[model samples]
Target: MSLMPDRKTIMLVLKDVTQENQYKREKLEQERKFIEQTRMAQMGEMISMIAHQWRQPLSSISATSMNMMIKIQLGEYNLETKEGRDECENSFVGQLEKIEIYTQNLTTTINDFRNFYKPNKLPVLTSLKSVVEKSLKIIEGSLHNDNINIIYDYNFNEKIELYDSELMQVVLNIFKNAQDNFKEKGIEKPLIKITTKERSLIICDNGGGIPEEIMKNIFDPYFSTKDEKNGTGLGLYMSKTIVEDHHKGSLHVDNQEAVEGEGIGACFTIKLNLSSQSMEG
Candidate 1:
């Protein structure tokens, strides 16, 4: 209606545009920070997982070798004649078996990290139970230290058909969140339970439940109960994307349990398609 532009009108238009750009820049930065945070968190988780995976076998290897050395010192090993060859062979074979177990685990760890950190690909038939198992193994140390017991109620009948690495990331994210949440709340006995049947589900910690408002925004990017220094709010959001977009699955969180663990804290449910070969599942 007013074709003739006034100084106030021009100033207002410029202000609006500036504000819009600022908003976009902030959003972009938040997104970048979120991505960087995800990468860092993943790397940290992997490092810890590797250490945990290697810890037990390494300890066993050390102990076994020490035991063997002590036996040799006490003339427990017989190698004086040809008749002693069989005994020596048996003992060395046992040691070799232990070494083989350690090597096999090391190889599996390398492969798991490789698959996880590799570039994204389409979904395929992956063992869902195994994927989550690897993730749990990765964080076992932390779980033990926090007195957090993880209960895995799953049927290992069929391999879960989904994006293997993506599914793992989803599982890891939920587990880390559970552990962190429990620690933050200072709970004495933290418990995380994972169940997989028709759908893969994980439940953890029965302390403070998520608020109504936060529940609505749980899947929204940059929505976090943690402070800026602690959390970026992208973990769950990215998990949702990985499950829904990449893996053709779904991830959801409920504040209360449907049956048992009622009045408990948060529970996360993830549903994924069974691999083509998995007919019964």
Candidate 2:
């Protein structure tokens, strides 16, 4: 007979397998929840867009109907009054046409929303520049409010192929978090230096530096410094997930060189794979 394993050995092996499986299952569940939550938020934004699209059409319908009713009451709806009746008919028809255009806009918005909110989708190659612009727009108000200056150094010699939507989210999230942090610190003449090269992008902020002790732990999920009113702690975590897991990119951070009389800062570098068109690390 083959040598028999001890009961303790068997028990330890079973425990290890059980824990590994449980860890995987839990991670899968968290990913599921995260995707669902993001999709829901996007749906909310789309709903707002849908409403915005119909505003002009609905306004045109209401205004035209009121004016037509007024003309009828004033006995001005007669076709025999020279070209006056023809003019009124033409005006009403034009307003109705405006309404139809508005309605079509609303329908188009709904279609676009549906496409964006779909699941289990793979990304196609898109430009890095477009992602930068979209992220800048999202943080424009905050940047202005904080009096922080954004200087872009677009030195990329090659086009970066990326998933447009997800990369946009990653960049936007980083900018917003930096803006908020700097705003709280009351840093004057706050400067955000954005520099991009053929294979990497760097974002630096003059909002004082990240504490040395927490440097490595910054990427840990559910870890944040801001209070409940300010931070969800997921911004950086999600950013890492987007760049690393989704885009196969690499990201790292370091302390920015200090400027005399100005506070310290942190710089984040994101490296992209231009040749492979997808990050491997």
Candidate 3:
């Protein structure tokens, strides 16, 4: 009689990843929508800044055009004699140059605002100082109108890879917050000091310090100290995300007992490191 081998057994396993993938997709979609919302919320402030930047240039252009028209109407330029013609030519050329300069100023202002709204496609080699300067240029007019002073102290200017436009947004957020605080508190001689150190950018404003109890929640999404009508509460949250999640950096704040000898205020620090991939570039 032949002996038969015992029957062999086999096992198989299957997993359903549909729910997991769906959850990921939902989270991503939510983040994308929130980013757009944040941009829209900032649009009002952006428009205000553009108006501030354009006002002076537009006024200058108008004045120059009026002056040219008046001169032509009144026959102020003697065009008969050779010498008179030379003088008229020189005057018109000077006026034209002024108009050109004013027009260029208008163009630059628009470009700055346009670039601020444009999303970056690639990381750029830049420095914290450079980014800070660009951000300041955009808001400086508004600050001047508000009588807010900016003191910039440079210590580190090393080049690093970053999404410069995104970083600019973070800087602008901090600056706008400081300005609002100054206005709200009615701080006298309002001042904001910016300092760049080894891999860190620090901004401090003498607008009274943030309350310790509420400081912890500042980075949480949709948390705001301002009234509902004034604050969408996404600025700091988006800023923290840009610095930490997108750039792989760190952002923190503290109550500075004294900032540049200007008394107690809120201070924000942004620390960045070169990414592994960017190090070679």
Candidate 4:
């Protein structure tokens, strides 16, 4: 009998990934839509804040201009005598200085808001404290309008690499949430305490804690505690995505009981690696 050469059969299995690819594409599109929607909602809130911020400065400018006009009409300055001319010049300079200061403030406010809305093309090296301060500045007028007290307890100022404006958005979202909660609960003494430690930021509000049942779902997309009119349900979800997914950080929340005479409420903590290596990764 002739020995037959051993033959081996190889089988190949192939999968058509068309459906999977299509699903992924659709998911990305949905996320883009969510981002755009969230941005529109934030734009509305920002416009309101901008109006609040500009109101006083604009009023001051108008008042200053009117005062100067009145002074000119009344012929208050004696321009003939040397001393009178110097005094008149000084008064005009003083009024001009005030107007300049107010104008500068208005310009700064515009720049702040513009930089905030401008998209970041690259990560920036910045201290967490600075980012928090910037975010606070943007929303300061709104906070003042609502009579909300913001307390700062910064224990960290290390520089880290990240998208500052995006982080600002996250900060603003948390502030807005606290503000809304304060209004809804009618907290008499609304307070938000911001504390930074190591590589973490903690924001605590005394606007009553998140309900136990809803706490688990706070980070879920389209989940909201506020009614349809007030809540887009994307703030916390986008915030979580920005910190964790985009920056490789962590965001967590919990209810804190009253302690040391402090009011009880919700607390949000964000942690990011401080090392440059981590950011690069």
Candidate 5:
């Protein structure tokens, strides 16, 4: 008869395995919390952008209403005279049209944020150009406020199967980081350049380059160069996870340099494989 394992040996091995599993569970829980924190921060930033986007339209509507009231008070909007009535009617119609346009813009902003933050049920083939455009819309207000110029060069025409919302989040995060850097450093003529290639995209900022000493640590969790009030340090880490870990793609960064050996800020590159078959919802 073959000898069987002793009770003490079996119990010791089982105990070790149990402890290892418990340790893994704890680590996973911590990571889950970190991801949630970053996501909440992103939502808050998006809301700020929405507020900015709505401000101009709301002001315009208010001004138009005030003007109409002023005209009425001055007895310039008489309904009895055909000329006065026509002028009043035209002014009213113009104001109404302006209000309609503003209302549509507000509605679109809400929908874009909602869709961008909604959890994805599954990965699908998505156009990169569409994703970039949506991400820009989400943060356009913030960029304008910071007086940063954006240049987009879409050189590729293809779709990749992936989580669209996740990708957009990554793109938005990068842009927000660039904007903050420009503000903090007070860079002159701040610019963000986004260029697409056959299967990759590059985002470069003119807010000076990442220091060589800290470049390698940029992707590490909870590692941020910004002051505590402005940064949680999880944005870039989570962005790396979404691009490289979750999507089976690649995300890397480097200091863009000129041929004369001058630093030209940092460039983050993302690459994804083109999907042969598109997935349906």
Candidate 6:
């Protein structure tokens, strides 16, 4: 017969186990709520971006339609003449093609957003280039509408073990922050440069840098430099958590400037491991 622990000892051990399980449950619940809230916030931003992107294309389509109608009403577009009819038909077809292109772009944007919001059950080997490109596609509309120029540098063709969508979320958050800063400060010639190294990426924007006073607390929950009307303050905090706590990576920020006082900008740097392993840890 095997000897077991005394009754009192067994009770104590069981109590500890129960407490630990309860703590884990509570932590899991909190994480679930946080993820949900963050997703909702991102969806709201996506809607705004879609509106900005759709507006120009929709306006072009409307103007094209009106022009065609006017031409027809004025008898300038004559179906009887091959040349005149061909000209009008070509113009209409061209506008329809443009509309189709824009519509396809919008559909792709929605798909990206939907894929990103899904839960990642396990880490997969994904290329950094693809991840960055996908993140850019989601926000390209907003960037274009704001007239901000994006410069991509560096190349990472190798794969990394990560939840790609989570990493994409971090990239999107940093990019949107830079964009917001540029618009808020009215920066002329706004530019965002993204460069990647073997296992890291640096995103910098020429929108002026974060103030030293608030830099330390930038990643703290509920700490926001933007006014309440513009920010919920969880973005950077969540990004940090995703990088450090979830992916076992590093996320840092610095003020980058070529000279003492010129081209001062905020730079966010992220580093990840290149190995494949269990993300559950």
lDDT of each residue in 1-281, candidate 5, tens digit only: 43664533333433458888999999889878878989987777877899888888888888888987888898877789999889999988998898899889889988999898788878877777778998988889878888888888888777777788989989998998888888888887788888888778889887788888999999888898888777889999989888886788899999886212345788999997646343243
Candidate 4 residue lDDT tens string, 82-152: 99889888888998899999999989999999999898888898888889999988999999999988889
Deviation from native of the Cα of residue 212 in model 2, angstroms: 0.9
User: Each candidate: how many clashes?
Assistant: 1, 0, 0, 0, 0, 0
Better of 4 and 5 by TM-score: 4
TM-scores for every candidate against the unseen true structure: 0.71, 0.61, 0.89, 0.89, 0.87, 0.84
| lDDT value, candidate 2, whole model | 0.68
lDDT against true structure, model 5: 0.83
Per-residue lDDT for 266 in model 3? 94
Model 2 — which ten-residue stretch has the worst lDDT? 7-16
Off by over 4 Å in 3: 1-17, 260-262, 276-281
Candidate 1 per-residue lDDT over residues 1-281, each given as its tens digit = 57765634533433458888999999778766766778686786678767876777788888888877887798875688776777877887898799788878778777867777775556566566777776766677667767877766775456556666666778888888887787888865667777766656555557566777778898988777887766777889888977786667778887775223446678888877555456464
CA shift at 135, candidate 2, in angstroms? 1.0
Poorly placed runs, candidate 1 (over 4 Å): 1-37, 81-86, 127-131, 144-147, 153-161, 197-207, 223-230, 247-250, 257-263, 271-281
- Candidate 6 backbone clash number: 0
User: What are the Cα lDDT values of the candidates?
Assistant: 0.72, 0.68, 0.88, 0.88, 0.83, 0.82
lDDT (10s digit) by residue, model 6, range 1-281? 33665544433433348888999999889877776777777788888877876677677777877876887798887788999889888888987788788678767777887888777889878777778898987888899988988888876556778889999999999999999998889988888888877778789888889889998999987787888767788889889989998888899998988212366999999998658432231
- Superposed Cα deviation of residue 89, candidate 2 (Å): 21
Clashes, model 1: 1
